[model samples]
Target: MSKGENTRKRIIAKSAELFNQKGYASSSLSDITELTGIKKGGIYRHFASKDEIAVEAYKYAGSIVSGKIHEALDRETTATGKLLVFLKVYENVVEAPPFIGGCPLLNLATESDDGDPVLRENARRGLDNTLELMKRIITEGVRSGEFKADLDVDALATFALSIMEGGIMLSKLDGDNRHVRSNIDSLTAYLKTVAAAS
Candidate 1:
């Protein structure tokens, strides 16, 4: 990579880490520069402002976590399997650092709080897209006889998103995985009750 490209990437990477660790509101350009070892001028060459880095960094983080979910959902051969896989994916995500602060969408949504239009819109889109994905899976499950014919896919999907986000928030605040597991278990049980036999 060119020197300029490398420096830009370094800034984005460092910003992502700090944002995930301290949140968007708390992280500053100085924190990013200190962690990246890049000069303010060099960073300016890449990003115009902290808001720019935040928008890009938050997008990067969202893509990372979403990629994992996409992978899990893609690997499952059945709708029921995919549904279960979604729960498992969150359970696994709770294991380590990047995910320790919980879902970036939730963080950005709450922290931005109608502040940064870009970040808030991105978070809104991410959340909406995630719910849509879940709804699609549930819709397919019903068509394939894996979910109840009369099931309310949209309602269930909204609930799934709520529980997962709430669970992650609680897990992060409490610094424990139990809430995450509990949420997954509750989701699983709820799905089973609504599932249709193949």
Candidate 2:
């Protein structure tokens, strides 16, 4: 990559980490500059304002989750296997420090709603993207004969997304992963029943 491209990436990466760790409202431009070792003027060269950086960072985090989910789905051939893998991946995410910050969309939604339009829009898009991905996976499962023909892919996708985000929020609130893990276990079991009925 060119020097400019690398610098932009560095700023985004650092901003993502800071936002995840301290939240968008709490993280300051100085914090980003200090962490990235890039001057404030340099940051402005890449992003017009802190809100812009926050929006980009939010997208960056959501893309990370999408990539991980896609990878898990790609690991198995059958729809049932893919669903199982996806649930298991969430279980594993509970054990990872990175996810300890919780879902970026959930975080941003809680903080940005009624406050910042850009941040709210970013969170909304992240959630919409997640729901779309789940819908696609459920559709695949149906085509593969791993899901019942009567299944409501849209509802299931929304429910799955809600459960995952809800579980993460509960985990963060309770300061324990047990609740999240249990919810995930239940989700997996539920997915198995749906797959078996196909």
Candidate 3:
């Protein structure tokens, strides 16, 4: 990459943790400059505004975690296996999150809920897309007879997302992975109950 491109990337990479931890409105250009060691002039040269930087940084963090999820899912062939893999993907989030603070989706979504239209939209987009992916998996599981035909895919998908975010939030708050571990066990047990066959 060109020098300018590399600098821009460095700025985003460094500030992603800052934004995720401190939040967009709370994270000033000064904070970014301090964290990234790139002055206002250099930062402005790459990003038109703090809003732009926040969007890119949020996306950067989201991509890292989501990439891990997809990679793990790719290893599982069955729908039930994929579902288990998905839940297990965040098993280490409390101890070794993709970033320092925690889940980018939860952080940005909660922080941007009452502020930053652009950010709120991006957060919603990410969330909606994830729900759709999970819904698709559940739907396929039903069609393939792996999951019971009567399963409510939409409701289950939404519930699973809630469990994931709630578990992650609790895990982060307590600095313990037991909540996540419990959530995984509960979800796994529930899925086994819904399985079409043993």
Every candidate's CA RMSD: 1.8, 2.1, 1.3
lDDT of 2 by residue, 98-165 (tens): 44365777889999989998888888887777778778879988887888888999988887777777
In the range 1-198, model 1's lDDT, one tens digit per residue, is 898887777787678768877988888778888999888898888888998998888877877787877887778877767766655666644567335356788888898777888888988888888888888998998998888999999998888888877877787777777887898889888989997765
TM-score of each: 0.92, 0.88, 0.95
Question: Which structure is stronger by TM-score: 1 or 3?
Answer: 3
lDDT of each: 0.79, 0.78, 0.86
Compute the lDDT of residue 186 as modeled in candidate 2: 80
**In terms of lDDT, which candidate is strongest?**
3
lDDT: worst 10-residue window of model 1 = 92-101
Candidate ranking (TM-score, best to worst): 3, 1, 2
In terms of TM-score, how similar is model 1 to the real structure?
A: 0.92
**In model 3, which range of ten residues has the least summed lDDT?**
80-89
Model 1 superposed RMSD (Cα): 1.8
By TM-score, the best candidate is 3
Give the Å shift of residue 153 in candidate 2: 1.5
Candidate with better lDDT, 1 vs 2: 1
Model 2 C-alpha lDDT versus the unseen true structure: 0.78
Query: What value does the lDDT take at residue 69 in candidate 3?
Result: 85
lDDT of 3 by residue, 1-198 (tens): 899999999988878899888877788999999988889999999999998998999899888888888998889888777776656777877778766788889999999997889999999998998899899989999998899999999898988888888988899888898888898998888888889975
